[model samples]
Target: MNCKEALPLIHEYLDGDLHGSEAKELKEHLIACPACRTLFKQLEQTEAMVRSLPPVRVPDTLTAQIMSGLPPMKKSRTWTDWIRKHPAVSVAVVFAAVMFGSYMSMWNDDKNLMVKGNDLQEVIIQGDTVIVPQGHTVNGDLVVQRGKLEVEGDVTGNVTVIDGSVNLASTAHISGQVTKVDEAIGWIWYKLGEIVNMIGS
Candidate 1:
């Protein structure tokens, strides 16, 4: 198996999810390719390090604090109910929100943008730098333009870098593709395609 074919399967192989024949083929390729083998080893070590980290402890009054900060819930009919009933529409709404949030964040003046917390459903973008802090979980894509992306958290979507670099810290956990393009023209095309996808969804 080629590097391209084996790369995506590495995670599955590590999880013991790959079939026997596929695993054997990947193992053979890893033995023959130094680059792939090194990448596999790094990923394995990162996973081990993450597993060794201590768990975070939440405050006992966190629930009460959250409840106190929020407005009282109402029984009135709302768009939220409709959205819950239509999962497809809900997904589309989330996509639109992510796209919009990402686009807006790109315009901010901050050089270092950070995304932290759990159950986040927004795409993140930064013109200078984007940091996904450790222990955070993001449910959407991340885009970095003319800068860098530092991911030390969990990402449920893709990571795209344009004319920049990506650093996946030891604690980072990504469930989707990671893409980096150095060309300005290619980045423009990619942005256009992403916008089209957001609108189409």
Candidate 2:
């Protein structure tokens, strides 16, 4: 199998959905072709990264409240309903809410510390260090601004560290992207966009 034929089947191979003969052929091609092998490894890494993000679990009551806060969606609604009707907007709202709630839960203490509980679903911030303790599980994304993120637990969502670093312990299991934005201007833009999205929503 050539690169052209092998590239498209990479996902199926990774998913274990390819037939035995097809899988064998792809494996052979990957072994013989350096470029294809690199692409295959990259794809594998991407899949692993996605599978490692923490899962976000919103409470039923919170869901009800958000739904109640939104204007009613009518079958005939158009332009004015764009914000509420847009799937991406809705997802962004939920993500922001979850992150906000997580950040709120960590209020009152400002010291650099680590997560202590199991089955958590909030964002935490420490002065310069944010640690997700061993055995702890976070169902929401984690954002650390001007600090570092140390993950030793299972996270089902994304981890974003602005102008800081990320350290994943041996036991760390993340199911989403781990992003680090080091540029000051980029961080400002990101924060601004976040604020705008929340306000728009």
TM for every model, in the order presented, reads: 0.39, 0.38
Compared with the true structure, the alpha-carbon lDDT of candidate 1 equals 0.58
User: Per-model C-alpha lDDT, please?
Assistant: 0.58, 0.59
Superposing all C-alpha atoms, what RMSD in Å does each candidate have to the true structure? 16.8, 14.7
Span of 10 residues, lowest total lDDT, candidate 1: 102-111
Error of 2 at 52 (Å): 26
Off by over 4 Å in 2: 1-127, 192-201
What clash pairs does model 1 have? none
Candidate 1 lDDT by residue in tens digits, 1-201:
898888767767755579878988999999999988877775564344324322222222432342365444332323233333333343344445445652212222233333232233223333455667787777666666667778888888787777778999999999988888789788788879879987999
